[model samples]
Target: MASTTLRLPGLGWALLSLLLAALFSSCCLASASPVMNGPPTTWLSAPVPAEDTAQLRVFLPSPEARDQFLWRLAGAGVSADLTTLGFCSSRCVDLLVPEVDRQAVEAALPADAVLRTAERNLGGRLRAERDRLAGDAHRTDFSGVTRASDFFEDFRTYAQIEAFMDSLLAAYPEALSGFVSGRTFEGRPIRSMVLSVGGNSTVVDAGRRSIHLQAGQHAREWLSPPTLLYILSGFLEETSGSANLPLRDLLSQFDIYITPVVNVDGYLHTWKGDRLWRKNRRVNSGSNFLGVDLNRNWGPNSTWCTEGSSTFPGSDVYCGTEAFSEPETQAMSQLLDSLPNVALAIDYHTYGPMILYPLQHTYDPAEGDDAAHFDHLATVMADAIRAVHGQEYEPMPGSQLYPHSGGLIDYAYYTRRIPAFTVELRGDGFIVPPSNILESGEENYRGLIDILPLL
Candidate 1:
């Protein structure tokens, strides 16, 4: 038997060839494209090349020494990103420096100033970790009622958070109250919730002193909102008779106001576009960078463009043109002003397990009269937190953490004269693994419970 040969028409053959060429081109492009999961791509495209950078944990005896070294680094035209702030003299700061200038940085340091390698190939590591976490997040099931695990399993997107909030309100209508405080710069509503026995009716109770709790001021701290949600969940349980009587008694006396995510625009950006976007999405005039660190935009004692903040738009700690320039900050400040009595306030952040009080602008305590009281409160809260996870959370003045000019805790205490504190939750930096969420939530809840009596 002889096999017959097949032939196609000229036009058909040309079309087939074109299709094959297109397929080959597509594959080539896919292979050539860089992997883009992880920290904001904008960060990698910063002035210094990310591949040639190394993250160093510099240990110094004092904050002054660290500042002096940083000044020297800046003078040498070396770019350094401050990743973590500490409270004591022997504080270790994580700084990303170009590999080319690593030797110069080491040489510029004093004899006692030691540098330890934290991360090499910073962009690559961040991308790999992000991709891994994203993959794990895809495996989560969000079908029925969200369990305690669901909130802590992985970082939720903005839509997921909104959905969770809706479910929460629907589940416990009497114990939780929800509202829109104000709109963000990007037109997103800044949602808030009140935990009280009467829910919505709590607003009418003029005698009730309110306690405000806020998180997500910096968008990259994905763990902040969930931790607050965890605390909220405990409050709900107390109202439902599942928790202890003491908790119920404490919760009933005051309305607990919680803003889960303050930087709504930036939080969305972290979920959809970049995993490490930190500031609110506010466009700056004549600058390619777009955002202002909400934490640095508060007023009444705002030392803008000073230490712990930057005037340059590209800097991570970029303070806005003026105090309360960002709409998110404006909305929050207004809310605080409108409340008849805000006895206690807490601004939650992440990456450092510390409880910080006022006077962030300077090392000196501005509220000298209330200094002892603040310390006692912080100590009690810290002890409560440590009981759960055995994690030692340093309780100190915010200024000891770093020389931050404008901060929420400072504004709340100084301008409003309300007792406020900043709780910096600890994990693997900003991106805490889902496994640690529940423990963090539980520990923080214990701390809050201890704090209520004082409030």
Candidate 2:
């Protein structure tokens, strides 16, 4: 064999190349941990050292106690992938915590306390950054609407949002068509809107191509419901005598149904008390226990309390005592199942800037290419969003994100066969600057337009 050797680049060029590579890698890593810029919607946990342990979990007295603990812990230096469990008391804290953090964190806690710990999941760093940003609440310039739209003023209370919805209906009697689907356990209305293209047809009776969109499914994902409301305003506001032209066109092709603030009670809680509250305000059976994670309340009976959920009613990912126990989730479930033609569905959340497709409630992969419908659509939509607003997002299967079972996206796809996606929006935090709200929504709004046309 002839002796041959490749020459190295010049010192300067080599250094430059290394620097660029490092910068790119840094950007990618940062992207992986989407930043939060508002208040948290759930409680924090105990503090831990970074890059020290592979996993960490804390023993929470109850789900609510866990929330408060996690919030405080996040404020401290510790973060971990959460696996909310029901039966963890002081004695069994070791069962959940990573072997490394178990002894240290447990020693720091009360002797008789239960345990909370991290699973072998990689969500800790991301959760910390997101939570940090979420805690940075501020005000920003209003840039959501092009023309002079007055909807952007003070942060709307639950009462204000309802008043706005009511006004829309009253102002455009014929234009408004929809249902107050059901009430939250706390008696809050789960309002849904219908922009009927063919005038007077029930959404459940809609055809196979009918489109479904929802926002504010996770009460603490603050960017979602407001963006939805803004989009609704755009649809109703007649610009140049063609106000809803684009939206009207969309409605003509498919029945447009939007539900903002599905978890009305939780949404209100975010506004009123804790900005990080994730569960619905449903009173648990005994004691002063309160709330259930409505998002995890949709598992089929057979798959309840699997992964991606907690059996504890107080955990943020808590699956309810039973599937569909929350009236809000139940109402949506009935409506989705009744509508044979729900070709597409979106359950919007924020603080990740990722588009998540189905198969959440189960680890079983799809049987065929049919499952690719959501995956492909999500990519297209995310790309479209980036192009319009210069925002970036990742599109991936729901399982890749957290691998939870009994999620809304899973039920929509596996059970109903509707191509659904759960969109995780991002910002500093849930109480994000009012100014950023419109811009964030605009980016997503454009993305929605891109995907809606294809559907």
Across 1-455, the per-residue lDDT of candidate 1 in tens digits comes to: 11011222222222232233225433212212342111111111122225555667788877667755654454443333322222223255666566666776787687998787766666665566567667544432454333454656667877777777887888887778789998899999999988776435435467778888999998878889988988887677656754567666777778888999999998887766355677888888876667888887888643543445555455566677888888999988888877767899899988678888877766778565787788889999999999998988888888776667668888888767777888989763554457677888889999988978886
Clashes of 2: 59
User: Residue-wise lDDT of candidate 2 within 7-61, one digit each (tens)?
Assistant: 2222222223223322543321221223421112222111121234334434545
Output the TM-score of candidate 2: 0.67
For each candidate in turn, the TM-score is 0.82, 0.67
* Every candidate's lDDT: 0.69, 0.57
Name the lDDT value of residue 294 in candidate 1: 89
Q: How far out, in Å, is residue 249 in model 2?
A: 3.1
For candidate 1, give the lDDT of residue 160. Answer: 75
Cα TM-score of candidate 1:
0.82
